[model samples]
Target: MSAKKEEQTAAPAFNLEKAMMDYSGDKYELIVMASILAAQKGKNEEFRFQPRDKVIKASLAEYLAGKITREQLVETYMSERKLMEEKQAQEEKRLEQKAAAPRLELKLSGESL
Candidate 1:
């Protein structure tokens, strides 16, 4: 077998441009890619799961390459961001309510409001 044929039989090299082109027509997949990009940017160096970002990026590329649809990628990342935002908002509201609550203190026997 020729060296070129052997190389071809080897795993294909990763191609980001092709992946992006593939998913360019998909709005949801684009959104998912954006979110994954965001998450990767926000990841801390101390964390062990940072490698997942690469996986997500690869998946995005694969999806863009027509190996997967926008819906599939969207279902995971889009919903996760939505749910996280909602939970964050709820927590913020709860904290605000707690902060806004009136404080009461016990007075001495002779004290009165």
Candidate 2:
């Protein structure tokens, strides 16, 4: 086989520019979404199978495959961040209330003596 053909075969079919154009949203948004996806996927055990591929490429592939969208990714990330913030605030409030709660102390009673 020719070296040129071998090189073509070795290269992935994915075209980054073409994939970005295929995305319905703006290219910039697609890039942002890929970044967010990579971060999210990095933390996920299910996505750990593709350790050889860069997270960003895997993320972009996911977008190209139509498995997810920029809006969905952004919304989900924002909602999760908000929920985490709320949970942290609640924990802080709980700790504050516990600290503020009056502690009862036992006093010696003359009657008992």
Candidate 3:
């Protein structure tokens, strides 16, 4: 008798709602879960999933699970970190310019004048 072997398939994309339904305890549960998963997946050794990444992953999972659409998830990951960094850099430049500015003082006719 001949036996047939099944083809292996990649794991289904993560499902946020299903995960939430499965874990259903707190709001941050999804973030924590994704972080743990990401850590295990070795996405980053620092294992520090930025807030933006956390939101993105959660929303993406939800969309993949048919709970939300890709468009909805698009804005969820938009982070202002880059803008903030640029603003900080500009502020530092301004400060450095100010510090580098020259100061002038004039002393006229001490009391003898």
Candidate 4:
């Protein structure tokens, strides 16, 4: 086995590019806890699991409702982002279909058909 092949087959590094982990002493060390969990769970080669600001806000709703724990924030963000991406894909496909379809002209009541 070549070292280069082994290196290529190795697992991708976890990337969490955010300052959320910097703050402490508030909310029971939840930020650090969530950061750790996100790093552990969000392992992918294509992209890092970066929750958008909106995703963070949306997850806060779930947190407030007691539906999700603080540590689940990143996980919740992933779920919401995936669902949003799916909806966006569907909408884009629909628009393409609409654009491809032929349009019909409708005559006004007072105009000739």
**What C-alpha RMSD separates each model from the true structure?**
5.8, 5.9, 12.4, 15.0
Structure candidate 2, residue pairs in collision: none
Greater-TM-score candidate between 1 and 4: 1
Better of 1 and 2 by TM-score: 2
Clashing pairs in model 3, backbone N/Cα/C closer than 3 A: none
lDDT of 4: 0.56
After TM-score superposition, what is the CA distance of residue 81 in candidate 4 from its true location, in Å?
Answer: 0.8
Q: Which ten residues in a row have the lowest lDDT in candidate 2?
A: 104-113
lDDT of 1: 0.66
TM-scores of the models, in the order given: 0.45, 0.60, 0.35, 0.35
Flag regions of model 1 displaced more than 4 Å. Answer: 1-5, 8-60, 104-113
Model 4, residue pairs in steric clash: none
Worst-scoring 10-residue span by lDDT in model 1 = 40-49
lDDT of 2: 0.82
- The TM-score that candidate 4 achieves is 0.35
Report clash pairs, candidate 1: none
Model 2: CA > 4 A from native:
1-12, 21-25, 48-53, 103-113
Better of 1 and 3 by lDDT: 1
lDDT of each: 0.66, 0.82, 0.54, 0.56
Q: Give candidate 4 regions above 4 Å deviation.
A: 1-70, 105-113
Evaluate model 3: give its TM-score. Answer: 0.35
